[model samples]
Target: MAEQVTLYTNPMSRGRIVRWMLEEIGQPYKTEWLAYGPQMKSADFTAINPLGKVPAIRHGATVVTETPAILAYLADAFPQAGLAPAPADRGNYYRWLFFTSGPVESAVISQACGFTVPDDRRPMVGFVDMQRMMDIIASAITANPYVAGDAFSAADIYIASHLSFSTRVGSVGSRPVFADYIARMTDRDAFRRASAIDDEARAAQASKG
Candidate 1:
């Protein structure tokens, strides 16, 4: 039986990444937009995700949270999408995908807040510092066309979303590699369609007030 996928999200939240991924994968999904504050904390929605976060997915009877996990799950479930890397390429695939969610995101958030790991724990940190993480990511793209090598997979969606979000939030400076990556990802028809729909929805809500 084909799985039924439903996404609960808000456009302004991290859920946007999942939204883009859904569009890229061309899966049919039902979206429930939750407003902030009391609406998101409502009992009905809270049951699905105790954390009251957006981007939760109901696939059949299973509920999945966390952006990276959702991305990985969708890719595997829909093999026809060609988003998952083959078992042979699992090493690079998992490395870049998890790196974006783990170190790269952590480093960006920490740097934005002007925080750093204690000197003694620096080596234990996945990303010693934002600059180092940025340098490594930039070098990877310059060295290889894609995050997990030549093939574009779900890893690209995750990495591209992070790079795009980082650049937009000023966490990442305007570098050529960042600029190039964003340009390429945004140029995709799927991305453009999702972005346009989100923009329209936001505009409609604004005009109602």
Candidate 2:
């Protein structure tokens, strides 16, 4: 029998990304929703994630955290879903996936928090400028139908999610390329399903508050 897969998440957190990926994989899994604050920082949840962050998953004995890592793990674990490209065709896959997870997100979040890298220190930073980062992203996405290749992959999920949030929060400029890519990547049943689940959960939380 396949080991049960369980997700520890809050609907309002980055767990939404994992939810979308799970929907894409079409797997039967359990979701353990934890409210923010004490619930997340409690002893039990901390055992699963010392950092007490949402979007962590346990596939039997295997525990995975971080949105990008979770997406990558799910894609590899369920190869039949085809969320990962062929190993030979994975150059762009690994590239954009890590890029978005690391430099892109770091830059976006840093800027959003009103922290800017000094111009002289740009050389030391992993990402130089927001416009430059956006341009690079635009070029990569335009080069292929998807970030990894002609077919959709886990990279798209992470990249699209990042861009969607960043653009919405004014961290990244709105561009036709980004808008089109996000629409194309998310114009699927999985994305819609994930959105609906999170939306409902978020609404319920608001009602309770």
Candidate 3:
């Protein structure tokens, strides 16, 4: 049976990541593209995700929000996708997952929005600084073909999304390491199919106005 998954997302948002996950899932799914401002903040949408964020998915009765959570859920929910590493290799699997999802995300978004802590209070920031955090990510990917040692996992999806966005926003340098890793990840057939759909959707939405 086809999976009954409803993806509620904004065409131009992090929803692309969930779309990629859906493509990787290789199951029939529906998408309810949402508009920003009032539409996203509407009561119905808020009931799905209190924060009114895109990339939220409704799988059966389970609703998952946040990019990392959604991706991880899909990986587990669709074991045939081969999105998770073996049990033994999961040590680094989860380590980088939380790291990229938490501190690294804060660092990148905060810097992009001009939100920063003072020098004295910088220590309170888990990532400390964007450059340092990115350097850590770069070194890790440079050493391994994938984030969690050898296997390709949902962890790669989260980290790769961050790296791609970080480069666009100038949060991280466009070093060869970052570019090479992204190239490797994005080249996957699943990613290509998902991104093509998102790109078309975004273009169509833009042309409407």
**Deviation from native of the Cα of residue 184 in model 2, angstroms:** 0.6
* Cand. 2 Cα-lDDT: 0.92
Instruction: Give the candidate number with the greatest lDDT.
Output: 2
Candidate 1 runs further than 4 Å off: none
Q: How do all models score by TM-score?
A: 0.93, 0.97, 0.94
Q: Between prediction 1 and prediction 2, which has the larger TM-score?
A: 2
The lDDT for every candidate, in the order shown, is 0.82, 0.92, 0.85
Candidate 2's residue-wise lDDT over 39-154, tens digit each?
99999989999999998999989999999999999998989999999989899999999999898988888988999787788898888688899999999999989988899999
Better of 1 and 2 by lDDT: 2
Residues 1-209, candidate 1, lDDT per residue (tens digit)? 28778989887777777877888889788888888788898999999999888889998998999999998988888888887778788787788889888989888888888886789988888775677788888877666777777777778888888888888878888788888987876678878878877777777767877
CA RMSD for every model?
1.6, 1.1, 1.5
Which lDDT tens digits does candidate 3 get at residues 30-87?
Answer: 9999998898989999999998878799988899998888888888888888888876
Q: Model 3 residue 190 lDDT? A: 88
For residue 9, give model 2's deviation from the true position in Å.
Answer: 1.2
